[model samples]
Target: MDPQLQHSVAESVATVVISHPEKRNAMTAAMWRALPPLLGELADDPAVRVLVLTGEGGTFCAGADISTLRGSPQEAQGLAVRAEEALAAFPKPTLAAIGGHCVGGGAQLAAACDLRFAEEGALFGVTPAKLGIVYPSSSTRRLVSLVGPATAKYLLFSGELIDAERALRTGLVDEVLPAGGLGKRVAEFARVLVSRSQLTQAAAKEFADGRTDRDAHWAAQARASGDTAEGVAAFLERRQPRFGWSVPTSG
Candidate 1:
């Protein structure tokens, strides 16, 4: 069966599932290409204020298919780069609900998100070193920004998968759930995110990704925008702030 970008909605949350179980949720060039536009459509919807990316079965993602691995170094890097760009550019809050394995390109994809949660038995790695593939400088920078240089180097050099506890200790995962509870826990986390102010979420998301080249000085303006005002007002009144009520006018 072909890969699919399955989408669903609950109030302000938009859930996107990577449905390619036959391949252990491995991503393909087409799926990587499909993601940015799909996210754009969901972000454009006023009712969609948060995005949850996950795999259909127990696995989060196993990385690129070994079957479709043919490409120049630049081509492979470009494909992975675009996938990361899409996840980073998503306007609302983003979360990765991780399970079995998040390796190679899959690891890079999850790192692009604002937050990540994993099951007890999850594994993570950047296996390019073992595969004799050169890791992109941007991906290396992002990894270092998350887990620090020493740990990043260890992972890259060894290409060894780290367990859930090590991943949590290294700050790769915000929370860890029991194997059976991972899905439900991630759902709860997504719901909690959706309950908050979209504007604050967007600003915070950008701030958390401050190391990214695109998250420059304009973030200050974003944090102080009308959304912050409405959010503070709603907090004082003890009500859910009506957010994503309209599309943001471009500058």
Candidate 2:
């Protein structure tokens, strides 16, 4: 059976819940493919300024459904790769509300987003080492971008779980929320993401993401793009300017 998503549309924020707490919401092959389209809906909705990804029953995710993986390792691995790629391609600001176990491919899912908010006691792990599975190159780069080379190496090679505080210190999570009011805090935090200027945020995110290799031409091209123009115009005009954003065209 397909796992049902708990959808919420409130105040221009689309909250997508991974509902399979019985297994800590481990994503099946189907769920992996389902995510991008669901997120795309929110990404295209002018009314939805933010897209929040979370899991049901206080758990974020435990990675790809391992039991299913045991059946056909190659197929399951392909699904994870495809899903991760889709997530990375999503345009707009994305946030993850992480609680409980965020392990293996779950960690990949969180890392794909623009921002992460984890509650106290959240556990994060990259378990490919344990399974002898190789992570995709882009995912590895994203992880390294999040926490830097040494920390990324530690997480990848060690596959050890890190607490929320440690994850925050390592830059794995943008912020740590109190365990008691985590849900409400996630909602409030998502509001901040929603209220932020899409133009400025999108450009900044794009600029930061593409800055890794430092291609002078690519950087200049982004600035030449109308996003920069609209951002400057909005600031000078003291008004909101619509941003016509699409999936980032550059790596």
| Candidate 2 C-alpha lDDT tens digits along 78-183 | 8777777776666677888999999988898899888899989999999899899887788899999999999999999988888999999999998898877777
Clashing pairs in 1: none
Worst 10 residues of 1 by lDDT: 242-251
For candidate 2, the lDDT comes to 0.81
Alpha-carbon RMSD of each model? 3.1, 4.0
Q: For candidate 1, write residues 1-251 as lDDT tens digits.
A: 68977999987678888888998888888887888888778877877777889888888888887666776556766877888888888888889999998998889989988889999999998998877888888889989988999999999999999998999999888898987998788778778877776555655666677746545545555565566677778889999875533335222
- Cα lDDT of all candidates, in order? 0.81, 0.81
Q: Residue 3 error for model 1, in Å?
A: 2.1
Candidate 2 has what TM-score?
Answer: 0.83
Backbone collisions counted per model: 0, 0
